[model samples]
Target: MSERPVSTTDLDSYIADLRQLQARRRPAEIPDHVVYPAGEITIPAHVSHWAAQRPATTALTFEGTAFTYPELDDLHRRLAGWMADQGISRGDRVAVYLGNSPEFVIAFLAILRLGAVHVPVNPMFAPAELTHELRDAEPGLVLTNRALASTVEEVQPRLDSPVPVLIVEDGWADAIAHEPFTGDDGDLDALAALNYTGGTTGLPKGCQHTQRHMLYTAASATTATQLSAEPGFTSLCYLPIFWIAGEDLGILLPFVLGGTSVLMARWDAATTLDAIEAFGVSVMTGTVENYLELMARPDIGERDLSSLVDPQAVSFVRKMTPQVRADWAAAAPSSGTLRESSYGMTETHTIDCVPYGFAADDEDLLAEPVFCGLPVPGTDIAVVEFGTQTPLPLGEVGEIIVRSPSVTDGYWRNPEATADQLVDGWIHTGDNGRIDEQGLLHYLGRRKEMIKVKGMSVFPAEIEVLLAQHPLVESVAVVPTDDPDSGQRPVAFVLPAEGATVTAEELVSWSRENMATYKVPLVKVIGALPMTATGKVRKHELAEDAAALNR
Candidate 1:
């Protein structure tokens, strides 16, 4: 790709051409109405609408317990009112620290209903990691289950102020007795949630999204993927609800379409298969790792998965091979030959490109590097030069930038970051990719040094800092190496302290104890790390070396 900056007129023309291509690929009519004419459509609005329209409809099912639309609405309303009684008002941030349970969904909707911002803390985060978010967000209250209340309490004293902690089980009775929230609709521009993403700076940054952004995400995803919200429309929720994609598919899409959502606390291949068969789940989305686990199950062949419709997978870590696709098709004969695939990030609330009615035999399209399909309706994407914002020509690798109604406003309380990333209404997604002649986007790799294990973003700087703390290690640099099943795994190059000795296995074991499973790096002992003349570690060189060593 040319480094020379393209003229503004030329760049605009290129963007226009890309949009035209996207228009050509768009469906004639999106199956559902994504855009709402109402001034400010919020999550609470969706819940209330569904509650009145389909009171008896099953809205959520979790571990043998089912909650109907009206029941869920009542719970959320009462919870919102209870939150108000606790002095939690609109614009205040409320952190939700819990696993994927009915309580997680209830708390999330309750926060939105109260017009408060929801801050989802990764349940896998260690106390220190959790503390960082608490200090940064300084939320008014943290809602957690009894199992995780200790973690929240541990981080409470570390915050700038003494924030209240609401244990879900203890609060449930009070919330049920509390009056339902009868507040007016929230302004579309009001902040809805603060999604924290790993930063290269070794800290987490919160992405501020508005009510309008949330609604648009749900609408665009539904329309682009042709997802149905009919009575039988059901989705498997195995992915973490803390993540953006998970929130989109698991909560927003189902609630908006008035479909049933089967909730799982975590990914378990066997349980997921059983749920799919039992509930007749028609929609599911997960990383390639998820599918591989299902395929590895001996009982997979016997399980009936015909209810699955257009199951999608993010093929970043491991490309879905022809054989795997064939096996999946055979296993779930009702879901045609091809399982859908797409590309997205947390910054953009939902996916950018969807297969938009792709057929199974379209191998030419699927062969592309995790072939990201065309842009969804009301979203525009461009491939621009890495450093400069100049648009690149088609078929050339460059930075991928996006402009969409659902794209986040900016990072919370981080104006410098906001200015650096959100430029001229376009989020400069530090992701590297190219647009083919057919208008499909192909993900080459990330321009940033972030490591993707499975579909989770793991920052190397965070891991390096932790590893460097070990007495056995003097220096360390983390790099990502391609993994057939995980998309990419982190490999750490460590130089032992002078006259000290440490084994790779020892460090790997230590990592498993100290960090989240996905963030743990595969240890590779090296005498010295490859570095440039300025003494900065050349991560690219180390990545190449790690790749070779892995092979």
Candidate 2:
């Protein structure tokens, strides 16, 4: 897979290709305050306010069940009492290992209602992955559905102290209906959650966030999306709530907007479109793949999608490029704008820079690769020199530094990692990017993921984004392999479009003509690219495959 393509010898011959061609930068302008209703600022506060004011309004709809705001609040309050009785209390960690369902939301808020730290574990985790989280979090209790209960049970005995597991079932209503939690609310500054984040490299690390952090994320995101309760704001939640991105879009955003969420356990283009048409879903947020899949469906244009507005898109396995936005607008005329969702990480509770309606205003902004629009209101984003931490000039690519209200307290129980990553108040995002003169941030890629070929730096994401433009390419992942001459060389694993008979040589030729000679990578055809549960490419897996070929 890592073998150099014969058609391209400019990499080895390398005479006049020191400078890599770069796309012109056109940054989007940051906005002032995003419009959001004042008052109720926290999740519990929102629940309480809505329950008292708009009790009959539906807050969540799952499968065939619907719960009004008051009913939803009441049920979680009862569950919180049950958790309290099970020895979960303020500051205690309670892990909710469940899929996307009403149960997940119920368990989540119930845990928070008790002032306990909510630890969301991905249900797709295997026994080993599950064990690592449980061990690190050391939760006082675990909540899961019947199907996932055994996975928790399997990992419980491995913990230093066995933790209690509660299966969220119908009987949960009976267990706590007689009693409701009357506990005091957690302090805004109190630790609220352990949002876990990781890659293909090592054990997942937990980012400690506070209720204040969560509240700011929820509120600012509401502003960013321009969500309003008037005339009703509704969204679809098919993405797993366990993920930071999912937690924000699926749960927090609606809570802040005082809107309704129509939940689906997972992604299915047909069901999502049906939900949008049936429920008048006004706003939608998901990966780029979701919108693409929707457009691919023949019935997309036929569906009654007049109510659906601009869908918030996250760039994960697939980037939200100019072409995608153009295609989406053509396929669904009602979609007002299609742009990258919030630019953040779990460390910032997932929203540091916000993108809303920017693409609609500036077509040039869409052309920038990995463009993360504007910092959150009241937050500071700085680009600094890699080693000295000296602030870099605008438009000069460097390390990104973000200090926001939504920034995490720190990594849980990992002082060494925390001290290294967090300085003063800013979180040093290991990502490489640059803020343009217009203030738009362009995330070049992960610093470690950059390939040093000959003497030039090549960003893998830029290569992948470029290759994906070809009509014959379905997907592509680029990984760096060691080279004797060049410090490292990019090896691309190409997934051709179905039934397309394009060969590696043809791809290499296309790359040589379309891209910089040094930037052109060795192309290898593959049936499928390895992916994580939340739709992230497993670059480590690809790198390993490339390493073996080199060996």
Candidate 3:
């Protein structure tokens, strides 16, 4: 098969362009220093800088509405003053249950400005799950959309601890009066946000990150990916602000860099395409599935997407099929625009990203699709094999360990789980990857997702990719189940392409022909595959459904 069309000048051109852009903008040849002063990391600081530099420039454009830098800055200051007057003390956690809107950004930044940690509650969570997080965080207050207040109220009376809840409604009277109140500047060392991630034992654990941690994350990400606006650059904010990748790059980084952000409350293929052409969006970050959906649209080819600097960003580790990579490069030429891939977990502040594509002579960079690039400035990374716990040689697949100023201190009060994951000051990134001779990183799989079949280790992601190539297969989710006889067996749940059909036997035969016998799933179900909001298949749910099907 012919190799996919890719820009040979990818790395060379990117470095040259970025270096030139930096040099012309900065008096010194050094990379532009993002000044994040000590003592307090507040939204007010970023907003103030942007307001002073580009007061009239649009800061955010959401659903046909726009807010300039000064407008957003004024709102932040006023909200902060009101919050301080209402006695929301520094370091207090405040839950926010709101959709993607102007108020969402205002509320989040306002909470940060008041030196309060914002607990971003998942809007999709059930009342029980929502209540549990709220109770655990024990936030002093909650800022919720008027529509979601009922859910909060329903869970309120049942809680052992109650918190004051305020409604965020446009044109409504402020819950905290506009009267000014003096307050202390936030201590940057203080906690900034508490994001919940999956626990090792299948429970939710909060990851507390400080201002410096978040700042470092955003700075490093922007630097590594070269996320910039270049005067009229526009970015599509499709992912929810709750996701670290979306919030850091889509929202926070734009403001810090004085860039225009176009927002969408939800993802709709046709609407997303229309918005891209209408708003002249230059960049967007989303999964390959999203790009596929947009491209499948009948009118997509006719749409004027030349304004896009990158068709979209792809996760190499999650969706790194040779076909997928080829499709992306063809759609957005590496020399014309870049779709950089990134590697990082929630704990490390979502740091580390590498520009995409490799040329004939650039064999060094092509060694890993999960090339998160070299650690940004203060970060460190090491690859160690699983059994011996010894650092592995470059090019050997192993666990990717990291230590950085941005790494979380520990999970919230979970000492046992913390001890198991963190070792010798390194956060054992539950992720398996390898470093190439040229220093690029490649992700293999997550430790937790490793499946054991007949005493052999198998990665579901590897199997899923092969299954996805089948003509009838629209998507696939794989998991391991105990077989009583064999230690475990691979089981797959598949979603067929619309209007197409495939039997379990035929699917199994196809998989057998494509993958190794051990890797082939013994149990196969043809049906819809459950997915998260961000388009990642919820493998745990599929596994449960698969078990029930066999039973």
Of 1 and 3, the candidate ahead on TM-score is 1
Query: 244-276 in candidate 3: lDDT tens per residue?
Result: 766775677676567778888987888787887
State the lDDT at 217 in candidate 2.
80
Give the poorly placed runs of model 1, Cα more than 4 Å off. 1-8, 27-40, 292-306, 364-366, 467-475, 482-487, 494-514, 522-530, 541-551
Per-residue CA lDDT of candidate 2, range 421-527, in tens? 77767787888998776666778877656676643446676678667778999988989898765557889999999999788889988887556577788888999
Of 1 and 2, the candidate ahead on lDDT is 1
Pairwise TM-score winner, candidates 2 and 3: 2
Would you list the C-alpha lDDT of every candidate in the order shown? Answer: 0.80, 0.74, 0.66
Give candidate 1's whole-model lDDT: 0.80
Off by over 4 Å in 2: 1-31, 34-41, 199-201, 361-366, 448-551
lDDT of 2: 0.74
Cα TM-score per model = 0.89, 0.76, 0.72
Error of 2 at 254 (Å): 0.9
Task: Put the candidates in lDDT order, highest first.
Answer: 1, 2, 3
